[model samples]
Target: MDDARQPGRAYRGRRRAQAAHTRYAAVLTTAVVGAGIVALGVSTALPEPRNDLSLEASGNFDDVSVRGGTDRAGRSRTSNPMSNMPAPDVWILPMQRYTLTSFYGERWGRLHPGVDLGAPQGTPFTAVAAGKVILCGWNGGYGNNVMIDHGDGIVTVYGHASKLLCKEGQLVKAGDRIALTGNTGHSFGAHLHFEVREHDKPIEPLAFMRKHGVDIQKHTEAIYG
Candidate 1:
């Protein structure tokens, strides 16, 4: 009887040891799994790394060969909504016979998106050319403004007016009065602020006009003529 009890006691002790080992293994596995999940979350929260184009490389970003201007295997890139404009052929002058207070591409301590033609308050403003009115209303920071979409990826914008006479979608002729010059919207003085956009990008106004054969010097000549 004593021998049998000894064997039974030894078996019971072994069984308890096995159970403890199994419990420890389970706890270790849980801890490892939890740490792995936390590490994965931290990795996911990190921002993705991107390569910024250098200033020198920016000029070449539009090249048809290196950039997306070409297809996967050297095919020509097609521009969507391709400009249907009549080669940007139009003559534009500020509504009033005013001085050029600010020209395009000048760093005015800020991004000057257009040219400023200084006119006295209430000077009659007109359309630069014949175009359909895309916008003729008050806009944020552009009180009593007008925008003309003459098609062909070219658009003309006039801002800071005292009043808007034309309605939205009205067709305007060259030299037609569209509004009155004023220190409205965001302005330091009374001026007719104008912008010409080619596919929404603002380039030098006088140079662009010259490239289109609309002589900027003609403004002075026509005034004298």
Candidate 2:
């Protein structure tokens, strides 16, 4: 009887071992399937790679107009919003209201190199075009001067400023405020000595400005009167 009972107990023991092995296999399969699902979800959620060719092609930081130019990467300028804006005006008056006290040419037997626009002390003035500031601070005769280098060998100068609002290497847009009127340097009163140069040679600012659609005299009259 004891031998028969031993066989029954042995069978029960084997059944228990088989049941445990089955549960372990099921748990392992569930874990592997869950891990695979998680990996698939992560891969699908990932974002696509970004293309920076548009920004690189626009060149300058200012708003660039898209007029059918292609970059080295073969990207269209119109692909980005920053490349679609309209181009800014070529030139603008330095000061809104001022008197044309002096003209460009010989002054006291010396070349003045610029025109003097007289305005009240501490009056604000703007940049004539979009460019980078190449010079800022005091010069011998110009006193608190600021110079901007537009592309194509063109540069604009602002002299006798009561205060400078821009620094060297700063990029400025047309009509952006850059300084205030002052009687610094060799100035007689509060005024802005404005100049435009091509290849470092000063030109007739009045005629040059007229060609750009900005008449200095007309601008001053409209604002002052």
Candidate 3:
């Protein structure tokens, strides 16, 4: 009787071990399936990569009235037309077309520090390079001026604007619209007073721009043909 009971108990113990093994296998299969589902969900939720250097219209330009996009000849103005041009940094002309009314030198009895670019009163002007706005407001003779401080002791000034599109402490990129040409402060006509200063002293803007691979005189039209 004792030997018979021992075999029965052994059978019962084996059954209990089999049941525990089945439960562990089910839990492991569920865990694997759940982990796979989570991985699939994460992959679907990821966003596509984008190009960082590609030019895009800024929301700041939309807040103020400015002319952009295509021109009269159906040429695209927003795209980086000058991408092929060589420069230390991205640089663009202030206007598509403008007349050089005055240059940097002696005027009357005082030193004229900037070049006067003549255009329509409401014609828009852009920044030459990426920089932060150091000054934006009425600046005595500059009148409704906007100054951008590009790094390395370089600062670009836009004066005599009819409407200022940027503010102090604002960051701007090359080709970003900053103001509209106008006769303000000591200006005599609708024009943009453009200046390039190094360490607070004015330099010859055209030559400086040319050295940086931008010929302002020849490339006054569209950035590309």
Candidate 4:
């Protein structure tokens, strides 16, 4: 039994070498998997920026792969920023002589939902942008109203007017006079009740004013500060 050049001990030595290799392979596999996970976290950890000067949304994106992971190619997902930015236009004054008496969200008996641009009776009023007239007749509390449905879920309403110039289903361009300022229903004096809405919800006209590069406050502070 102790013959044939010690074959038993030689075979045991071969088995030990094989086991060492197997263990090394296992450790290598674990390290590769850990590195992949860390890389994925870095790729998807991008931050979104929020400000008026910047776009609405951030990242060059696609349909989310797993709500918080990369695509198969290991690239990060992002949404198109321009997709959320609404179209903006110039703020052309509708009347030659006008003043803002009431602003958006001013609390009257309840809440004043719009801005009141004061002008003389029968003064001409114009559209703020190119849009289709959705409502061209008298509204309950807004006499002789003209609501222009601008594209991209934007709408502009001219209320408390003395005359209506556009009809329903009519398309109008910017600076087109749509009505005249009046002291009609629910008005304090001769003024135009102007409203800018997004998704049918009223927003402040000053927001649009700032978008068009007009500062609500005096030019000195806005410029210096």
lDDT of each: 0.51, 0.56, 0.57, 0.50
**Candidate 3 on 1-225: residue-level lDDT in tens?**
011111222222112212323423533443344322110000001012222211111121221112221241132122223223222255556765578888887666445777888887888888886666656777656678887766556778798889998986566666667888888877788888888877655688998887764666765312221
The best candidate by lDDT is 3
Model 2, residue 84: distance off in Å is: 14
lDDT of 4 by residue, 1-225 (tens): 111111222222112222323423533443344322111111222123222211101111121123334452143124322223332333334443467676665363344556777777878777765556656666545666777765555667787778887886565655566877776665667778877766555677777756743333221111112
List the pairs of residues colliding in candidate 2: none
Clashes of each: 1, 0, 0, 1
lDDT of 1 by residue, 29-58 (tens): 433443221100000010121124212112
Better of 3 and 4 by lDDT: 3
Better of 3 and 4 by TM-score: 3
Which 10-residue span in candidate 3 carries the lowest summed lDDT? Answer: 38-47
> Lowest-scoring 10 consecutive residues by lDDT in candidate 2?
38-47
| Candidate with more favorable, higher TM-score: 1 or 3 | 3
Pairs of residues clashing in candidate 3:
none
Whose TM-score is higher: candidate 2's or candidate 4's?
2
Residue-pair clash count for candidate 3: 0
Q: Spell out the clash pairs found in candidate 1.
A: 85-152
Q: Write the per-residue lDDT of candidate 2 for residues 46-150, one digit (tens) a residue.
A: 112223212111121121112112241133112322232332334556755578987877655556667888888888888876666656777546778787766
Instruction: Give the candidate order by descending TM-score.
Output: 3, 2, 1, 4
Q: List the residue pairs that clash in candidate 4.
A: 61-78
Q: lDDT-based ranking, best first?
A: 3, 2, 1, 4
